[model samples]
Target: MYEIVAGIDKSEDRGRAIAESITEMPLDHGEVRVTLLHDFQDNPEGASVDQVASVRHARKILEEVGIEVVLEESSGEPADAILRLADEQDAEMIVVAGRKRTPTGKVLFGSVTQSVILGTDRPVLVCSGDEN
Candidate 1:
Protein backbone atom coordinates (compact mmCIF):
# COMPACT_ATOMS: atom_id res chain seq x y z
CA MET A 1 0.00 0.00 0.00
CA TYR A 2 1.02 3.58 -0.61
CA GLU A 3 1.53 5.56 2.58
CA ILE A 4 0.98 9.25 1.90
CA VAL A 5 1.11 12.12 4.35
CA ALA A 6 -0.72 15.21 3.17
CA GLY A 7 -0.09 18.45 5.04
CA ILE A 8 -3.05 20.73 4.60
CA ASP A 9 -3.22 24.41 5.51
CA LYS A 10 -5.80 26.98 4.49
CA SER A 11 -5.94 25.98 0.86
CA GLU A 12 -8.81 23.58 0.61
CA ASP A 13 -9.02 23.65 -3.18
CA ARG A 14 -5.39 22.82 -3.75
CA GLY A 15 -5.35 20.32 -0.90
CA ARG A 16 -8.30 18.40 -2.29
CA ALA A 17 -6.72 18.36 -5.73
CA ILE A 18 -3.51 16.91 -4.30
CA ALA A 19 -5.44 14.17 -2.49
CA GLU A 20 -7.43 13.34 -5.62
CA SER A 21 -4.31 13.15 -7.75
CA ILE A 22 -2.58 10.83 -5.34
CA THR A 23 -5.59 8.55 -4.95
CA GLU A 24 -5.91 8.38 -8.72
CA MET A 25 -2.30 7.34 -9.22
CA PRO A 26 -2.09 3.76 -10.59
CA LEU A 27 -0.81 1.46 -7.88
CA ASP A 28 0.13 -1.65 -9.82
CA HIS A 29 -1.05 -4.04 -7.10
CA GLY A 30 -1.68 -2.08 -3.91
CA GLU A 31 -4.08 0.33 -2.30
CA VAL A 32 -3.51 3.95 -1.25
CA ARG A 33 -3.72 5.07 2.36
CA VAL A 34 -3.69 8.76 3.17
CA THR A 35 -3.09 10.54 6.43
CA LEU A 36 -4.44 14.06 6.29
CA LEU A 37 -2.30 16.19 8.61
CA HIS A 38 -3.17 19.60 9.91
CA ASP A 39 -0.72 21.21 12.32
CA PHE A 40 -2.35 23.54 14.76
CA GLN A 41 -0.10 25.84 16.70
CA ASP A 42 -1.51 27.14 20.09
CA ASN A 43 -5.25 27.90 20.41
CA PRO A 44 -6.97 24.55 20.90
CA GLU A 45 -10.47 25.77 20.19
CA GLY A 46 -9.66 27.28 16.82
CA ALA A 47 -7.32 24.43 16.09
CA SER A 48 -10.02 21.85 16.66
CA VAL A 49 -12.32 23.65 14.27
CA ASP A 50 -9.70 23.85 11.59
CA GLN A 51 -8.69 20.25 12.10
CA VAL A 52 -12.26 19.06 11.79
CA ALA A 53 -12.80 21.01 8.62
CA SER A 54 -9.58 19.75 7.08
CA VAL A 55 -10.33 16.15 8.03
CA ARG A 56 -13.81 16.43 6.59
CA HIS A 57 -12.52 17.75 3.30
CA ALA A 58 -9.87 15.06 2.97
CA ARG A 59 -12.29 12.31 3.92
CA LYS A 60 -14.95 13.49 1.49
CA ILE A 61 -12.56 13.52 -1.44
CA LEU A 62 -10.39 10.50 -0.65
CA GLU A 63 -13.27 8.25 0.39
CA GLU A 64 -15.17 8.89 -2.84
CA VAL A 65 -12.35 7.21 -4.76
CA GLY A 66 -12.31 4.28 -2.27
CA ILE A 67 -9.02 5.31 -0.69
CA GLU A 68 -8.46 4.74 3.01
CA VAL A 69 -8.12 8.02 4.93
CA VAL A 70 -7.27 9.16 8.44
CA LEU A 71 -6.72 12.47 10.19
CA GLU A 72 -3.69 13.48 12.25
CA GLU A 73 -3.79 16.68 14.25
CA SER A 74 -0.78 17.92 16.16
CA SER A 75 0.54 21.01 17.90
CA GLY A 76 3.69 22.86 16.91
CA GLU A 77 5.07 24.61 13.86
CA PRO A 78 3.12 23.35 10.89
CA ALA A 79 6.06 22.25 8.79
CA ASP A 80 7.89 20.68 11.68
CA ALA A 81 4.84 18.76 12.80
CA ILE A 82 4.28 17.44 9.31
CA LEU A 83 7.89 16.36 8.89
CA ARG A 84 7.95 14.66 12.26
CA LEU A 85 4.78 12.75 11.50
CA ALA A 86 6.00 11.75 8.04
CA ASP A 87 9.20 10.38 9.56
CA GLU A 88 7.33 8.61 12.32
CA GLN A 89 4.91 7.04 9.83
CA ASP A 90 7.62 6.40 7.25
CA ALA A 91 5.43 7.99 4.64
CA GLU A 92 6.26 7.25 1.04
CA MET A 93 5.35 10.72 -0.10
CA ILE A 94 4.66 14.12 1.38
CA VAL A 95 1.95 16.37 -0.03
CA VAL A 96 1.24 20.05 0.42
CA ALA A 97 -0.97 22.69 -1.22
CA GLY A 98 0.14 26.30 -1.07
CA ARG A 99 0.40 29.44 -3.14
CA LYS A 100 3.47 30.32 -5.12
CA ARG A 101 5.75 32.84 -3.45
CA THR A 102 9.01 34.43 -4.45
CA PRO A 103 12.20 33.60 -2.63
CA THR A 104 12.23 36.93 -0.84
CA GLY A 105 8.61 36.54 0.20
CA LYS A 106 9.20 33.00 1.36
CA VAL A 107 12.22 34.06 3.35
CA LEU A 108 10.39 36.93 4.94
CA PHE A 109 7.19 35.08 5.73
CA GLY A 110 8.73 31.66 6.40
CA SER A 111 6.88 29.18 4.20
CA VAL A 112 5.65 25.88 5.64
CA THR A 113 5.75 24.24 2.22
CA GLN A 114 9.29 25.36 1.55
CA SER A 115 10.40 24.20 4.97
CA VAL A 116 8.84 20.78 4.36
CA ILE A 117 10.47 20.53 0.97
CA LEU A 118 13.88 21.40 2.35
CA GLY A 119 13.63 19.48 5.60
CA THR A 120 12.61 16.07 4.35
CA ASP A 121 14.33 13.67 2.00
CA ARG A 122 10.96 12.15 1.13
CA PRO A 123 9.41 13.03 -2.21
CA VAL A 124 7.29 16.13 -1.84
CA LEU A 125 4.39 16.91 -4.15
CA VAL A 126 3.35 20.55 -4.12
CA CYS A 127 0.05 21.59 -5.73
CA SER A 128 -0.48 25.22 -6.57
CA GLY A 129 -3.44 26.75 -4.83
CA ASP A 130 -6.34 28.27 -6.75
CA GLU A 131 -6.37 32.02 -7.16
CA ASN A 132 -8.81 33.58 -4.77
Candidate 2:
Protein backbone atom coordinates (compact mmCIF):
# COMPACT_ATOMS: atom_id res chain seq x y z
CA MET A 1 0.00 0.00 0.00
CA TYR A 2 2.90 2.31 -0.69
CA GLU A 3 2.27 5.66 -2.30
CA ILE A 4 3.43 5.05 -5.87
CA VAL A 5 3.18 7.51 -8.72
CA ALA A 6 3.56 6.42 -12.32
CA GLY A 7 4.54 8.76 -15.17
CA ILE A 8 2.67 7.92 -18.35
CA ASP A 9 3.12 9.21 -21.85
CA LYS A 10 2.06 8.74 -25.52
CA SER A 11 2.88 5.06 -25.43
CA GLU A 12 -0.43 3.53 -24.36
CA ASP A 13 0.64 -0.07 -24.15
CA ARG A 14 3.74 0.56 -22.09
CA GLY A 15 1.94 2.97 -19.79
CA ARG A 16 -0.91 0.58 -19.11
CA ALA A 17 1.53 -2.24 -18.52
CA ILE A 18 3.46 -0.13 -16.03
CA ALA A 19 0.29 0.78 -14.17
CA GLU A 20 -0.82 -2.83 -14.09
CA SER A 21 2.57 -4.00 -12.90
CA ILE A 22 2.61 -1.48 -10.07
CA THR A 23 -0.86 -2.60 -9.02
CA GLU A 24 0.45 -6.14 -8.75
CA MET A 25 3.28 -5.23 -6.42
CA PRO A 26 2.94 -6.08 -2.71
CA LEU A 27 2.85 -3.02 -0.57
CA ASP A 28 2.55 -2.85 3.21
CA HIS A 29 0.44 0.25 3.96
CA GLY A 30 -0.71 3.38 2.11
CA GLU A 31 -2.86 3.64 -1.00
CA VAL A 32 -1.30 3.88 -4.43
CA ARG A 33 -2.04 6.93 -6.52
CA VAL A 34 -1.23 6.41 -10.16
CA THR A 35 -0.82 9.71 -11.94
CA LEU A 36 -0.84 9.92 -15.72
CA LEU A 37 0.97 13.06 -16.86
CA HIS A 38 1.25 14.26 -20.45
CA ASP A 39 3.38 17.30 -21.24
CA PHE A 40 2.16 19.12 -24.30
CA GLN A 41 4.56 21.50 -25.96
CA ASP A 42 3.47 25.08 -26.34
CA ASN A 43 2.29 25.58 -29.90
CA PRO A 44 -0.02 27.71 -31.99
CA GLU A 45 -2.39 24.79 -32.50
CA GLY A 46 -2.41 23.70 -28.84
CA ALA A 47 -2.37 20.08 -27.75
CA SER A 48 -4.00 17.19 -29.53
CA VAL A 49 -7.60 16.60 -28.44
CA ASP A 50 -7.38 12.92 -29.23
CA GLN A 51 -4.28 12.46 -27.08
CA VAL A 52 -6.02 14.03 -24.11
CA ALA A 53 -9.04 11.81 -24.60
CA SER A 54 -6.84 8.70 -24.83
CA VAL A 55 -5.12 9.49 -21.53
CA ARG A 56 -8.46 10.06 -19.84
CA HIS A 57 -9.64 6.68 -21.07
CA ALA A 58 -6.50 5.04 -19.78
CA ARG A 59 -7.05 6.68 -16.39
CA LYS A 60 -10.50 5.15 -16.27
CA ILE A 61 -9.10 1.67 -16.82
CA LEU A 62 -6.54 2.11 -14.04
CA GLU A 63 -9.18 3.52 -11.71
CA GLU A 64 -11.21 0.34 -12.17
CA VAL A 65 -8.44 -1.64 -10.51
CA GLY A 66 -8.72 0.41 -7.28
CA ILE A 67 -5.82 2.69 -8.16
CA GLU A 68 -6.65 6.33 -7.59
CA VAL A 69 -5.52 8.25 -10.65
CA VAL A 70 -4.79 11.90 -11.22
CA LEU A 71 -4.66 12.92 -14.86
CA GLU A 72 -2.43 15.90 -15.58
CA GLU A 73 -1.78 17.87 -18.76
CA SER A 74 0.99 20.44 -18.88
CA SER A 75 3.39 22.28 -21.18
CA GLY A 76 7.09 21.60 -20.56
CA GLU A 77 9.88 19.06 -20.77
CA PRO A 78 8.97 15.44 -19.91
CA ALA A 79 11.70 14.89 -17.36
CA ASP A 80 11.00 18.15 -15.58
CA ALA A 81 7.26 17.54 -15.47
CA ILE A 82 7.75 14.05 -14.11
CA LEU A 83 10.20 15.08 -11.41
CA ARG A 84 8.04 18.00 -10.37
CA LEU A 85 4.93 15.84 -10.11
CA ALA A 86 6.76 13.19 -8.16
CA ASP A 87 8.00 15.76 -5.67
CA GLU A 88 4.57 17.36 -5.40
CA GLN A 89 2.96 14.01 -4.74
CA ASP A 90 5.67 12.91 -2.31
CA ALA A 91 5.71 9.62 -4.12
CA GLU A 92 7.50 6.70 -2.48
CA MET A 93 8.21 5.22 -5.88
CA ILE A 94 8.29 6.75 -9.35
CA VAL A 95 7.49 4.44 -12.19
CA VAL A 96 8.13 5.18 -15.85
CA ALA A 97 8.67 3.42 -19.17
CA GLY A 98 12.19 2.48 -20.22
CA ARG A 99 13.25 3.05 -23.79
CA LYS A 100 15.18 0.34 -25.59
CA ARG A 101 18.32 1.68 -27.17
CA THR A 102 21.60 0.41 -28.50
CA PRO A 103 24.73 1.46 -26.62
CA THR A 104 25.60 4.04 -29.27
CA GLY A 105 22.09 5.45 -29.39
CA LYS A 106 21.87 5.70 -25.60
CA VAL A 107 25.15 7.54 -25.50
CA LEU A 108 24.02 10.00 -28.15
CA PHE A 109 20.38 10.68 -27.15
CA GLY A 110 20.91 10.39 -23.39
CA SER A 111 18.34 8.18 -21.70
CA VAL A 112 15.23 9.56 -20.03
CA THR A 113 15.24 6.55 -17.74
CA GLN A 114 18.74 7.37 -16.68
CA SER A 115 17.83 11.00 -16.18
CA VAL A 116 14.89 10.11 -13.93
CA ILE A 117 17.01 7.75 -11.91
CA LEU A 118 19.65 10.36 -11.33
CA GLY A 119 17.31 13.31 -10.84
CA THR A 120 14.88 11.85 -8.33
CA ASP A 121 15.39 10.75 -4.74
CA ARG A 122 12.60 8.16 -4.89
CA PRO A 123 13.10 4.68 -6.24
CA VAL A 124 12.47 4.65 -9.99
CA LEU A 125 10.90 1.65 -11.61
CA VAL A 126 11.25 1.43 -15.37
CA CYS A 127 8.79 -0.78 -17.18
CA SER A 128 10.05 -1.86 -20.57
CA GLY A 129 8.31 -3.84 -23.33
CA ASP A 130 10.34 -6.96 -22.61
CA GLU A 131 10.10 -6.76 -18.81
CA ASN A 132 8.13 -9.52 -17.18
Candidate 3:
Protein backbone atom coordinates (compact mmCIF):
# COMPACT_ATOMS: atom_id res chain seq x y z
CA MET A 1 0.00 0.00 0.00
CA TYR A 2 1.20 3.45 -0.87
CA GLU A 3 1.02 6.16 1.70
CA ILE A 4 -0.58 9.38 0.46
CA VAL A 5 0.17 12.47 2.47
CA ALA A 6 -1.90 15.55 1.75
CA GLY A 7 -0.70 18.97 2.81
CA ILE A 8 -3.67 21.06 3.85
CA ASP A 9 -3.88 24.74 4.48
CA LYS A 10 -6.83 26.67 5.89
CA SER A 11 -8.94 25.97 2.83
CA GLU A 12 -11.45 23.36 3.85
CA ASP A 13 -12.96 22.89 0.42
CA ARG A 14 -9.59 22.37 -1.16
CA GLY A 15 -8.55 19.88 1.50
CA ARG A 16 -11.73 17.83 1.22
CA ALA A 17 -11.55 17.83 -2.55
CA ILE A 18 -8.00 16.54 -2.55
CA ALA A 19 -8.88 13.80 -0.12
CA GLU A 20 -11.82 12.71 -2.25
CA SER A 21 -9.73 12.65 -5.38
CA ILE A 22 -7.14 10.46 -3.73
CA THR A 23 -9.83 8.11 -2.53
CA GLU A 24 -11.14 7.75 -6.05
CA MET A 25 -7.84 6.78 -7.57
CA PRO A 26 -7.26 3.09 -8.28
CA LEU A 27 -5.13 1.68 -5.51
CA ASP A 28 -4.55 -1.68 -7.27
CA HIS A 29 -5.26 -3.63 -4.10
CA GLY A 30 -3.13 -1.32 -1.99
CA GLU A 31 -4.31 0.87 0.87
CA VAL A 32 -4.13 4.61 1.28
CA ARG A 33 -3.00 6.59 4.30
CA VAL A 34 -4.22 10.17 4.47
CA THR A 35 -2.46 12.78 6.51
CA LEU A 36 -3.66 16.33 7.10
CA LEU A 37 -0.90 18.79 7.81
CA HIS A 38 -1.22 22.40 8.84
CA ASP A 39 1.51 24.96 9.41
CA PHE A 40 0.11 27.54 11.78
CA GLN A 41 1.68 30.86 11.08
CA ASP A 42 2.58 32.69 14.25
CA ASN A 43 0.27 35.54 15.01
CA PRO A 44 0.92 37.58 18.11
CA GLU A 45 -2.65 38.85 17.94
CA GLY A 46 -3.94 35.24 18.04
CA ALA A 47 -5.56 35.39 14.61
CA SER A 48 -3.92 32.23 13.23
CA VAL A 49 -5.53 29.90 15.74
CA ASP A 50 -8.71 30.12 13.70
CA GLN A 51 -7.25 27.45 11.41
CA VAL A 52 -8.35 24.86 13.94
CA ALA A 53 -11.81 24.84 12.43
CA SER A 54 -10.51 23.95 9.00
CA VAL A 55 -8.28 21.17 10.35
CA ARG A 56 -11.16 19.70 12.34
CA HIS A 57 -13.41 19.71 9.32
CA ALA A 58 -10.77 17.99 7.23
CA ARG A 59 -10.35 15.25 9.82
CA LYS A 60 -14.09 14.60 9.81
CA ILE A 61 -14.19 14.22 6.06
CA LEU A 62 -11.30 11.77 5.92
CA GLU A 63 -12.73 9.75 8.74
CA GLU A 64 -16.03 9.45 6.93
CA VAL A 65 -14.16 7.82 4.07
CA GLY A 66 -12.64 5.29 6.45
CA ILE A 67 -9.21 6.77 5.94
CA GLU A 68 -7.08 7.11 9.03
CA VAL A 69 -5.61 10.57 9.37
CA VAL A 70 -2.49 11.89 11.01
CA LEU A 71 -3.04 15.51 11.94
CA GLU A 72 -0.13 17.66 12.97
CA GLU A 73 0.54 21.29 13.74
CA SER A 74 3.82 23.04 13.04
CA SER A 75 5.30 26.45 13.59
CA GLY A 76 7.50 26.92 10.55
CA GLU A 77 7.42 27.43 6.81
CA PRO A 78 4.57 25.52 5.18
CA ALA A 79 6.69 23.92 2.49
CA ASP A 80 9.33 22.83 4.96
CA ALA A 81 6.76 21.35 7.30
CA ILE A 82 5.09 19.39 4.52
CA LEU A 83 8.37 17.99 3.22
CA ARG A 84 9.48 17.03 6.67
CA LEU A 85 6.19 15.28 7.43
CA ALA A 86 6.26 13.39 4.14
CA ASP A 87 9.74 12.18 4.83
CA GLU A 88 8.90 11.19 8.36
CA GLN A 89 5.87 9.26 7.21
CA ASP A 90 7.81 7.58 4.39
CA ALA A 91 5.11 8.81 2.06
CA GLU A 92 5.37 7.67 -1.54
CA MET A 93 3.37 10.58 -2.85
CA ILE A 94 2.63 14.07 -1.61
CA VAL A 95 -0.47 15.96 -2.63
CA VAL A 96 -1.13 19.65 -2.26
CA ALA A 97 -3.51 22.20 -3.70
CA GLY A 98 -2.21 24.50 -6.37
CA ARG A 99 -3.01 28.16 -5.94
CA LYS A 100 -2.58 30.92 -8.45
CA ARG A 101 -0.73 34.06 -7.57
CA THR A 102 -0.15 37.36 -9.27
CA PRO A 103 3.14 37.75 -11.10
CA THR A 104 4.45 40.16 -8.49
CA GLY A 105 3.47 37.85 -5.69
CA LYS A 106 5.05 34.89 -7.45
CA VAL A 107 8.24 36.83 -7.87
CA LEU A 108 8.37 37.93 -4.26
CA PHE A 109 7.37 34.54 -2.85
CA GLY A 110 8.36 31.61 -4.99
CA SER A 111 5.70 28.95 -5.40
CA VAL A 112 5.60 26.34 -2.66
CA THR A 113 4.52 23.80 -5.25
CA GLN A 114 7.63 24.49 -7.25
CA SER A 115 9.80 24.28 -4.20
CA VAL A 116 8.29 20.96 -3.14
CA ILE A 117 8.67 19.55 -6.62
CA LEU A 118 12.32 20.49 -6.79
CA GLY A 119 13.18 19.47 -3.26
CA THR A 120 11.71 15.99 -3.14
CA ASP A 121 12.54 12.85 -5.12
CA ARG A 122 9.12 11.32 -4.45
CA PRO A 123 6.26 11.99 -6.81
CA VAL A 124 4.35 15.21 -6.06
CA LEU A 125 0.70 15.48 -7.05
CA VAL A 126 -0.51 19.04 -7.28
CA CYS A 127 -4.27 19.32 -7.44
CA SER A 128 -5.43 22.53 -8.98
CA GLY A 129 -8.10 24.02 -6.73
CA ASP A 130 -10.13 24.58 -9.88
CA GLU A 131 -9.97 20.90 -10.86
CA ASN A 132 -12.51 18.31 -9.88
Candidate 4:
Protein backbone atom coordinates (compact mmCIF):
# COMPACT_ATOMS: atom_id res chain seq x y z
CA MET A 1 0.00 0.00 0.00
CA TYR A 2 1.16 3.51 -0.82
CA GLU A 3 1.44 5.68 2.28
CA ILE A 4 0.91 9.44 2.29
CA VAL A 5 1.27 12.02 5.05
CA ALA A 6 -0.97 15.03 4.63
CA GLY A 7 -0.10 18.01 6.87
CA ILE A 8 -3.34 19.87 7.16
CA ASP A 9 -3.74 23.28 8.79
CA LYS A 10 -6.73 25.21 10.05
CA SER A 11 -7.87 26.44 6.67
CA GLU A 12 -10.93 24.62 5.42
CA ASP A 13 -10.22 25.49 1.79
CA ARG A 14 -6.70 24.13 1.97
CA GLY A 15 -7.92 20.97 3.63
CA ARG A 16 -10.52 20.48 0.89
CA ALA A 17 -7.90 21.04 -1.77
CA ILE A 18 -5.68 18.31 -0.37
CA ALA A 19 -8.56 15.86 -0.14
CA GLU A 20 -9.76 16.68 -3.66
CA SER A 21 -6.29 16.19 -5.08
CA ILE A 22 -6.07 12.75 -3.55
CA THR A 23 -9.51 11.81 -4.85
CA GLU A 24 -8.59 12.89 -8.35
CA MET A 25 -5.48 10.73 -8.37
CA PRO A 26 -5.73 7.42 -10.23
CA LEU A 27 -5.52 4.98 -7.36
CA ASP A 28 -7.56 2.00 -6.30
CA HIS A 29 -9.75 2.28 -3.18
CA GLY A 30 -7.58 0.10 -0.95
CA GLU A 31 -4.26 0.74 -2.68
CA VAL A 32 -3.46 3.91 -0.81
CA ARG A 33 -3.39 5.02 2.82
CA VAL A 34 -3.38 8.61 4.05
CA THR A 35 -2.33 9.85 7.45
CA LEU A 36 -3.86 13.22 8.27
CA LEU A 37 -1.46 15.18 10.44
CA HIS A 38 -2.08 18.36 12.39
CA ASP A 39 0.85 20.00 14.10
CA PHE A 40 -0.27 22.18 16.94
CA GLN A 41 2.14 24.81 18.09
CA ASP A 42 -0.14 25.91 20.87
CA ASN A 43 -3.19 24.06 22.14
CA PRO A 44 -4.23 25.38 25.49
CA GLU A 45 -7.56 23.68 25.08
CA GLY A 46 -5.80 20.36 24.60
CA ALA A 47 -7.20 19.19 21.30
CA SER A 48 -6.46 16.01 19.43
CA VAL A 49 -5.73 15.85 15.73
CA ASP A 50 -9.12 14.27 15.13
CA GLN A 51 -10.70 17.25 16.88
CA VAL A 52 -9.29 19.65 14.32
CA ALA A 53 -11.96 20.87 11.94
CA SER A 54 -9.81 20.88 8.83
CA VAL A 55 -8.56 17.39 9.58
CA ARG A 56 -12.09 16.19 10.13
CA HIS A 57 -13.10 17.73 6.80
CA ALA A 58 -10.32 16.00 4.91
CA ARG A 59 -10.98 12.71 6.67
CA LYS A 60 -14.62 12.77 5.57
CA ILE A 61 -13.74 13.21 1.91
CA LEU A 62 -11.02 10.57 1.89
CA GLU A 63 -13.06 8.00 3.80
CA GLU A 64 -16.09 8.48 1.53
CA VAL A 65 -14.06 7.12 -1.37
CA GLY A 66 -12.82 4.12 0.63
CA ILE A 67 -9.33 5.43 1.17
CA GLU A 68 -7.74 4.36 4.45
CA VAL A 69 -7.00 7.36 6.66
CA VAL A 70 -5.28 7.77 10.00
CA LEU A 71 -5.33 10.86 12.21
CA GLU A 72 -2.20 12.03 14.02
CA GLU A 73 -1.23 14.99 16.21
CA SER A 74 2.08 16.56 17.14
CA SER A 75 3.47 19.59 18.87
CA GLY A 76 6.34 22.02 18.06
CA GLU A 77 7.47 23.18 14.58
CA PRO A 78 5.00 22.12 11.92
CA ALA A 79 7.42 21.33 9.13
CA ASP A 80 9.79 19.49 11.40
CA ALA A 81 7.00 17.51 12.99
CA ILE A 82 5.49 16.58 9.65
CA LEU A 83 8.80 15.49 8.12
CA ARG A 84 9.80 13.54 11.21
CA LEU A 85 6.46 11.76 11.27
CA ALA A 86 6.67 10.99 7.58
CA ASP A 87 10.06 9.45 8.04
CA GLU A 88 8.88 7.37 10.99
CA GLN A 89 5.86 6.19 9.03
CA ASP A 90 7.97 5.60 5.91
CA ALA A 91 5.44 7.47 3.82
CA GLU A 92 5.81 7.33 0.07
CA MET A 93 4.68 10.93 -0.34
CA ILE A 94 3.96 14.10 1.61
CA VAL A 95 0.99 16.34 0.89
CA VAL A 96 0.62 19.97 1.92
CA ALA A 97 -1.43 23.03 1.00
CA GLY A 98 0.02 26.42 0.17
CA ARG A 99 -1.72 29.74 0.02
CA LYS A 100 -1.03 32.40 -2.59
CA ARG A 101 1.25 34.88 -0.87
CA THR A 102 3.07 37.95 -1.99
CA PRO A 103 6.82 37.59 -2.16
CA THR A 104 7.23 40.15 0.60
CA GLY A 105 4.64 38.42 2.73
CA LYS A 106 6.36 35.11 2.33
CA VAL A 107 9.73 36.49 3.27
CA LEU A 108 8.37 38.03 6.43
CA PHE A 109 6.08 35.24 7.58
CA GLY A 110 8.17 32.24 6.58
CA SER A 111 6.18 29.37 5.10
CA VAL A 112 5.73 26.03 6.82
CA THR A 113 4.66 24.57 3.48
CA GLN A 114 7.88 25.73 1.87
CA SER A 115 9.92 24.30 4.70
CA VAL A 116 8.20 20.90 4.42
CA ILE A 117 8.71 20.76 0.66
CA LEU A 118 12.38 21.61 0.82
CA GLY A 119 13.16 19.50 3.87
CA THR A 120 11.87 16.19 2.51
CA ASP A 121 13.48 13.86 -0.02
CA ARG A 122 10.17 12.11 -0.55
CA PRO A 123 7.84 13.38 -3.26
CA VAL A 124 5.70 16.30 -2.11
CA LEU A 125 2.25 17.04 -3.47
CA VAL A 126 1.40 20.72 -3.17
CA CYS A 127 -2.25 21.63 -3.46
CA SER A 128 -3.15 25.25 -4.17
CA GLY A 129 -5.27 26.80 -1.48
CA ASP A 130 -6.27 29.73 -3.64
CA GLU A 131 -9.87 29.28 -4.76
CA ASN A 132 -9.45 31.35 -7.89
Return the clash pairs for model 4, or none: none
- Would you list the C-alpha lDDT of every candidate in the order shown? 0.79, 0.72, 0.75, 0.92
Q: Would you estimate the TM-scores of all the predictions?
A: 0.86, 0.80, 0.81, 0.95
TM-score of 3: 0.81
Model 4: per-residue lDDT, tens digit, 16-104? 99999998988896899999999898999998988889999999999999999999989989999889999999999999999888999
Q: Is candidate 2 or candidate 4 better by TM-score?
A: 4
- How far residue 16's Cα lies from its native spot in candidate 3, in Å, is 2.1
State candidate 1's TM-score: 0.86
What ordering of candidates by TM-score runs from best to worst? 4, 1, 3, 2
List model 2 lDDT by residue over 1-132, tens digit each.
Answer: 456666666666767667667766775223767777777765467765235654665676767777777777667677888888889878788888887789999899877678889998889888874434
Model 3 C-alpha lDDT versus the unseen true structure? 0.75
Worst-scoring 10-residue span by lDDT in model 2: 48-57
Q: Which candidate gets the maximum lDDT versus the true structure?
A: 4
User: Candidate 1's residue-wise lDDT over 13-92, tens digit each?
Assistant: 77777777776677631387888887766664565633566567767878787888878887779999989999999999
**In each prediction, how many residue pairs overlap at the backbone (N, C-alpha, C within less than 3 A)?**
0, 2, 0, 0
Task: Give the lowest summed-lDDT range of ten residues in model 1.
Answer: 44-53
TM-score head-to-head 2 vs 3, winner: 3
The true-structure Cα RMSD of candidate 4 reads 1.1
Q: For each candidate, C-alpha RMSD in Å?
A: 2.2, 3.2, 3.1, 1.1
